[model samples]
Target: MGVVNVTPDSFSDGGEWFEPDAAVRHGLDVLAAGADLVDVGGESTRPGAERPSVEEELRRVVPVVRALAAEGAVVSVDTMRAEVARAAVEAGAAIVNDVSGGLADESMVPWVAHAGLAFVAMHWRGHSTSMQSRAVYDDVVADVCRELAERRDALLAAGIRQDLLVLDPGLGFAKTAEHNWALLAALPVLHGLGHPLLLGASRKTFLGRLGRHPGEPLRPPAERDVETTATSVLAAMAGLWCVRVHDVASTVRAIAVVEAAMEHAPEEGPA
Candidate 1:
């Protein structure tokens, strides 16, 4: 999956594709570069970000989704609102990538179920503005897995098709650097929840913090593509369902190398 943030305040590439035409063009560019899906989000969910009005979000997302889907791109609306999800689906979105995991909006799960679209339900604690304060976990990996399981049960109980649902661990949403690292190290535990996993570690702050010197600023989000690509290869090797990324071409190429190498490896054991 490739990210297309059609907002003026996303953590990365804000305002670069805020215009519908530009967003559609970028979506096409990502698809041509080997993205299996284009995730279009209007609201900026960066930490401490404010929510946009529903009307503004709908105006920003629907047209871009329509244009991209018309051009044969598999589109996912990265939204927390049922209203926006409904409009985007009407405009040709095939999936609803809700960061809140249908927890933020009461109407989201039902709407998604009725639409019969694929849903990526990410584990979220709260809205972006105050979510960091809620990042208290006893054991980061175990806690995240348990919480994600709860979300899975909730979504299934809400009438969403079990096969059509995907779970995301919500890497940077309400997690600390320690929490993020711990979760990444336990991908198999998350996968054991009996659902396909979606990872959105692309260009996030946690990855930027690795190897940084004391008092120095972390790597910038745009420059973290190298790190993101590494994680993309890791996700592919871990058997993840998808990896949401900002730079799709590099990740695609790297994953191709991993695939080719794995193809030649011994199936049962090392030689």
Candidate 2:
């Protein structure tokens, strides 16, 4: 998966693709770079970011989704609103990548079930503006797993098909740098949930913080691609089903290397 943020305030690469034409082109480029799908998000969910109205989000993403789908590219609409999901699906999105896990909108789960599109249920504590305050966790990994499991069960009860659901630990949503690292290290625990995992740690603030020194500025988002690619390689090795990233080409190459390594690994003999 590749990220295409068509908003002016996404923590990374926000206004760079805010224009429909630019966003569409970037989606195409991502697909060309070997991404299986492009995730187009109109709203910026960066910590402390304000929400955009439904009309504005629709205006931002619908056209880009339409254009990409018209070009035969698989597309996912990254939105919390059922209305926006509905419009994007009608416009050509094949998946709904909701960061909120259906918590933000009452109509989301039912709509997704009716549409029968792939739905990504990320572990989210609250909306971006207030989520940072909710980051406290006794055991970040265990707590995140519990919350994600609850969301999965709820969605199942809401009529969403078992196979249509994907789980994301939501690397940065309401998580501290330490929490994000813990989640990544606990990928096997998360995989034990019996659902395909979608890891989206691309260019996140945590990666930037990893390169920072005490009292020094964190590395910018673009500079974190190296670390993001490392995460991709680890995720692939851990059997994650997909990784959402901005620098798709490099990640694609990294995953290829992982695949090749696995393919040629020595087989166990009478172990």
lDDT: worst 10-residue window of model 2:
205-214
lDDT of 2 at 145: 92
* Residues 104-220, model 2: lDDT tens digits: 999999989987778999999999989999989999999999989999999999988999999999998889989999999989889878899999999998888884688899898
- Give the Cα lDDT of each candidate: 0.92, 0.93
Q: What TM-score, computed on C-alpha atoms, does each candidate reach?
A: 0.97, 0.98
- List clash counts for every candidate, in order: 0, 0
Off by over 4 Å in 2: none
Error of 1 at 255 (Å): 0.6
Q: Best-fitting candidate, measured by lDDT?
A: 2
Tell me each candidate's RMSD, in Å, in order. Answer: 1.4, 0.9
Tens digits of per-residue lDDT for model 1, 17-68: 9999999999999999999999999999999999999999999999999999
